[model samples]
Target: MLYCKDCQLLCEQECPQCGSRSLRKPQANDPVLLGVFEPAIAFGVESILKDNHIPYEKFGNLGAAVTLYVGTAMETYRFFVPYGEYRKSVSLVEELTGPAEPSQEHE
Candidate 1:
């Protein structure tokens, strides 16, 4: 019998609960900002979202040219969720990263 990695539950063919193929993973183009977190908190963020069944997407090293756009270079990472699920994703983000802090308006 083959084992499924996701859902943390073994299955005979596929994960009936999550409907994921045995050994395959899920992917999506979710929108909204979950949070901009460093690598240290990435694991917690991913875990909470996965457990909560929230679809999200992560991006890193967004720069195409290294010297031209130093600001968008590696080290910075982000998480985004679908627009409709923004509220749910926000709650999960808070659970992992604590309450959201106030921000100043961009000029």
Candidate 2:
């Protein structure tokens, strides 16, 4: 199962066909979207990707417009990215916003 702590949403435990939780995020190689901790961050990163012509999409509950607004306003979201693209996306984001500290890696 995949649990997005940032968005506080639980999705199907595994892929419908493969039953694997290793879903991949798109544009994992972008250099400006390490971790989307909040809806605002996701929106900002999405804009960056769009500007660069990098095809990407936000996953998890925060992707929903209503959920994003509620989560951001309430400050209770637990967002998460697809498992596969996490590393590459993080690296890209770090390159754009400076290297991430060890403690902030999971943030």
Residue 7, candidate 1: C-alpha displacement in angstroms: 32
Find the 10 residues in a row with the least total lDDT in model 2. 24-33
- For residues 1-107, could you state the per-residue lDDT of candidate 2 as single tens digits? 34433333223554433345653333433222234445555566666656655555555533467655665553322324444555555555665556766543231
What clash count does candidate 2 reach?
A: 11
Q: After superposition, how far is residue 82 of candidate 1 from its true place, in Å?
A: 0.5
Candidate 1 segments whose C-alpha is farther than 4 A from its true place: 1-30, 62-74, 104-107
Task: List, residue by residue over 1-107, the lDDT tens digit for candidate 1.
Answer: 33344433334566655777745332233244456676677778888889988887876645446525664334556676765566687787777778887631111
Worst 10-residue lDDT window for candidate 1 reads 24-33
**Index of the highest-TM-score prediction:** 1
Candidates in order have lDDT scores of: 0.59, 0.46
Q: How do all models score by TM-score?
A: 0.54, 0.38
